[model samples]
Target chain A: MSPRGRRPAGSPDAREAILAAARTAFARDGYRTSLRGVARGAGVDPALVHHYFRDRAELFAEAVVASAAGTGAVDISERAQAISRLAPEELGEGIVRSFVGLWDGLGGDRFSAVIRAAMSNDESLAPFRDFIVTGILGNIMDKLAPDRPELRGQLIAGQLIGFGVVRWLARLDEVASLDIEEAVALIAPTIQRYATGELPSSAA
Target chain B: MSPRGRRPAGSPDAREAILAAARTAFARDGYRTSLRGVARGAGVDPALVHHYFRDRAELFAEAVVASAAGTGAVDISERAQAISRLAPEELGEGIVRSFVGLWDGLGGDRFSAVIRAAMSNDESLAPFRDFIVTGILGNIMDKLAPDRPELRGQLIAGQLIGFGVVRWLARLDEVASLDIEEAVALIAPTIQRYATGELPSSAA
Candidate 1:
C-alpha cells in the first residue's frame, strides 16, 4: 500500500518532508525501520508515508537518492535509463562515472551505509544480492563478450567501488582527495583491462 | 617518545588498562582523542602509555586490533606482514582472511568501531591509507603485470573491500552470513579476472 496514497493537508511539502526524514532515518537506522519511526521523525502520521511511497523499497530508493542531495554524481537507481550510453570502449569511465557520481553526488553516505550494512547483516538484503549481481553488474557485463565481458565489467566495477570505499568511506587521504582525472587516469586502465583483458591460462 | 615509556606508579596493569582506555576513547571520540586523555581514563600517567606504545599510530593500531587483556589480534606493527602475501590472485582472499580473522579471532567490537570511525573520517586513518594502498594493495599488484596491475588490484580490492564493508560494517544480510568458501567462490573469480585479465586495447 502507498504510504500516502493521497496528499494530506500539505501535499508535496509533506511528501518532501517525509522523504527527507526517511533519508536520515534510513541512513541511520536502515530500511527495516518502521514507517511509524519515519513518521515520527518526519513529524507526520505513518500512513502519510505509505500514501506517498508504495512501500519501503520505493521509500528506501527515494530516500537513498534524495539523501544524496548535492553530489552531481550518477545515481544507480537512475542507471536503467542510462543503458543507452553504455558503449564497450567507454565502459571504464562509464562504470566509474556511475559509481563515483552516485557517491560524489547526493546518496553517498546513505547508499554506502545501507550497502555496507547489507553486506554484514544477512537479514536485510538477502533477496536483493543476486539481483544486483546478475542485474546491475551483470547487465554491464552482457554488453561486452559472454566468455569474459561480465568478468571484465565486474573487475572494472570492483576497482572503482574500492576507490570509493577508500576515498569516500574509509577516508584514505590519497583516495579521498585524489583529483578525479588522476583517479580516472589510474582507474581507467584497470577498467580498460577488465573491459577487454585476456584471461590468464590458470583461470581459463 | 613512547606513551608507555613513562608509566606512573599505582597502575600495575598499566598496559592492559591503556588498551581498554584507548578503545573506549577512540570509539567515543575517534582518532583525534588525546592519548593523555586515554591515559587519564585508564588511571595511569601519560608516560606509562608512552612506555608501552611509541605514539598514537602505534596506540590506535594496537587499540584497533585489541582482542582482550593479554591477547589482542596481533601487534599493530606486525600487520605489515600481511601485506607480504598480497599476490594478484591471492589479494582478495588474503585481505579477507586478514580482516575477518582479525575481527573474528578477536571477537570484539574494537576493530569495527575503528573501521566505522575511519571510514567516515579521513584524518583518523592517515597512517593506514598508505598501508592499505601501497603496502597491501600495491604489493598484490606487484605479482601481476606491472603495466596495469595497480588498477587491477584496486578494482578487485574494491569489490572485496566493499563486500567487507557490507558484511562487516553495513551488516547486510545475504553477504554477511555467506560461508567463507561460498564467499571466496563468489568473490574470488571477479578478483581473478581483474588480477590477470587482458588489458583492454583502450586501456593501453
Candidate 2:
C-alpha cells in the first residue's frame, strides 16, 4: 500500500535493509519484538517482512546468521582456525575464551536474542539447529575432534547453548551476572575436556 | 461429583492418585496431553485436577518432580552419593553412566516428557530449575567441586539437559538412537571435568 520498499521486492538492498532493521529490533527488544516495528524501522510494509521471511523464526534465524557472518561473531570456521593454532593442550582455554568473547562482547546482545529465539519453541529451534548446529558447530567439531565428532560436536553445542539459555534467557542470577572474563576462566576447562579428553574406561 | 477423590481435598491419596494419572498421561501422550484426559484417567473430575494444580505447567512440574523423587531419575543427591563412592578418576565415567542410565532406561520416557514440558515455556521451567538445578545438581556440585560449585553445576546441568532435549525431545536421530553404554562412554569425561577439574589461568 505504501509503495512497497524503497527498492523493488526482489532487490538485495530491500532484503538486507529489512534484515538490518530486524537485527536492531531483535537486539533491542529481544525475540518478542514485532515485525510491524521492524517494517516501520526499515521503511517497508509489514507484508514485505512476511514476504521475505516465512515467519518470525525464519526472519530471526536469517538475521542472527547474517550478523554472525558479517561480524564474525560466533563464526565457527574462524573459531576452529584460531583454536587449531593453539597448542593442543591450550585448545580448551582458547575455545572457552573465544566463546565468552562472542557472547559477552558487542555481539552479546544479538547472540542472546538468537539464543532466546532458538530456545523459545520447536519451530524457532529447528532453523537454529539447521544453521548453527549442523553448520557452524559441526564445522568446528570436525576440525578439532576427528573421532566421534558428531556426538562430541553436539555435546559442545548443548553445553554452550544451555549456557546461553541459563545465563541469558532464564537470567539465572549467578551464572548470568558473571563478568565475561570470570565466566571464561570458570567455563573454559570444561569446554577443553569435552573438546579433547579421554573418556573413562568401563569397569568390566 | 464422584466422591471427590476417595477422601477429601487435602488428602495425600487424592493428590497422589492425580499425580500418578498425570504422569501416566504425560508419558503416554507427552506435553500436549490435555488436563481433561488426565482427570479422566485419574477417575476424578477435571475440577479436581485444577484443585491440585494451577495449570498444565504446574501439574507437569509436580508430576515430573515427583517422578524424579520416586524413580531417583535426575535425583542429584543420590547421584552425588553414588559418585562420591567412586575413585576420583572414575568419577567422570561414573557420572556419565548413571546419567545415561537414568535418561535411557524406562525412566527415559518420563524424563523426556519432563524435559519437553520444561522447554515448553518459562512457567514450566521454574520448578525444574528449583528442584533439579538447585536441589539435585547443587548437591552433586557441593560434594564434588566445592569451588565455583554453582557455575560448574549449571554447566553440567546444561550439558545433560541439552543432551536430553537433543536426544529425546528433538529426536535428532543420531544422538537419539545411541546405545546407552555408548553415550555414557562418550560423555563421561566432559562431566568429570565440570565436576572436578582445574580452571585455566587467565594470562594477564
Candidate 3:
C-alpha cells in the first residue's frame, strides 16, 4: 500500500517539509521506513505527502537528489565531461581522482546512507543505477570510446562499485586511510587500461 | 541482546538443523529477517536457536559458511594457495579467474544473497569482511607481495567487490554475459598492476 495515499489539509510549506523529513528518514533508517513516519516527523498529514510525491520510491529519489543538488554534490554531468576531456592515458586516474573527491566531499555517513537506500530494493535502486549508466558512464563512453560503449561502461561501473564497497562499506584500513592522490595513483592506471587498452586474448 | 542466550534441549542434529534454517532464512530474507522466524522455520524452540548460535549475526555467518562448505563452494584457501604459486605477473589473472569461477559456481541468487546480507549492516558484514581480508586477500598478499601487504590486500578486495557488484548485483548485460576467460583477459592486468607496480605520484 502507498503510505502517501491521498491529499490532506495542505499548507504552503508542506512539500518542503515533507521532502526534508524524507531526507532525514532515508538517511537515518533507509528506504524501508514508512512515509507515515516521515509525515509524522514532518508534522504533516500523510495525504499531503502523497500530494507532493507519487509514492515512497519517488519520494526517496526526489529527496536524495534534492539534498545532493542542494549541496552541489550531484554534479555528475560536469564530472563526466571532465573525465571525457582527459588524455587517453590519464582517463583512468582522472576518473578515480574525481570520484574519490566526490565521495570524500559527501562524507561517509550521508554517502553510505544514499548507497544503502539505493540498494534497498530494485524500485529504489533503478534511478540511481540509471543515473550511473546512462548519465555518467554512457556520457563518458560516448566521448571516450564510441565502439563497444556498453561493455566499457559496465567495466567502469563494476570498478567503481567494487572500489566503493571496499573503501566505504568494508572500511579496509589501508584503503580507508589512503591519501587521495595515492589512491588515484594506484587505481587510475587500472581504469586507464580499461578505457584505452586492448582486451587481452582469451586464447593467450 | 544476544539472541542465542543459552543452549536449549540438545539433540545431536540440533546444531545442523539450526544452521540449515539460518541459511534458508538469510538467503531468503537477508540480515533484516528475524532470528525468531528462523527458529520457527526450523521447527525448533526459539531458545534452541539462541543456544546453538550466538546472535543473528553469528547465525547468519555460520549459516552461509556452512552452506558454502557443504557445497564445496568456499575454496578460497585452495585458490589462495594456487594464486601464491603463480608468478607475480600471473597472480592478477589467476585471482580474477579463481574468483569468477568461485562466484559463478555459487550461482547468482545465493552469492547475491550473501552480498546483500553483508551489505545490510556493518555488524552483519564483519565476519564476511574478515574472511575476505584475512582468509582471502591477506593470504594472497603474503605470497604475492610481502612488502606492501596491507595496501595490496585492500586493492584486491576492492577489485573483487567491484566485480561482484556489476556481475551479481547490477546484473549489467555486458558484465553478466562475459565468459569467465574473457573477463579474466579484460580484468587481470588491472589487478596485476595493483599487485606489483609502483604507486603513481600525485604530481605525475
lDDT of 2 by residue, B7-68 (tens): 45555577777888887876666555788888777777678898877556556556775464
lDDT tens string, model 3, B1-204? 125543346667667777777777766665556778887777677888878664554464467763643453355566676787887878888889988998888776556666776777776666667666765665576555555777777887788878887787767778888899888888887787778766555522
lDDT of 2 by residue, A60-151 (tens): 55677646434423344455456656775676677767777766664445554554455555555565566545445544664555556566
User: Over the stretch B1-204, how does candidate 1's per-residue lDDT look in tens digits?
Assistant: 236654455556778788889988876775567888998888787787888886565676677534322345455444435545555557555555555555555542444454544543444454345445554554455666666665665555566666555555444344455556655555555555566666555453
Model 2 DockQ class: incorrect
Q: Pairing residues by index, what is the TM-score of model 2?
A: 0.61
| Candidate 1 lDDT score at position A53 | 68
**Candidate 1: stretches off by over 4 Å:** A1-74, A80-85, A105-131, A148-157, A201-204, B1-12, B25-58, B67-71, B74-76, B81-160, B166-204
Give the lowest summed-lDDT range of ten residues in model 2 chain B: B68-77
DockQ of 1: 0.19
The candidates' DockQ values read 0.19, 0.22, 0.40
Per-residue lDDT of candidate 1, residues A30-88 (tens digit)? 45566788887777777778887655655655665334333322345456336425776
Q: TM-score, chain A, per candidate? A: 0.60, 0.59, 0.64
Task: Order candidates by DockQ, high to low.
Answer: 3, 2, 1
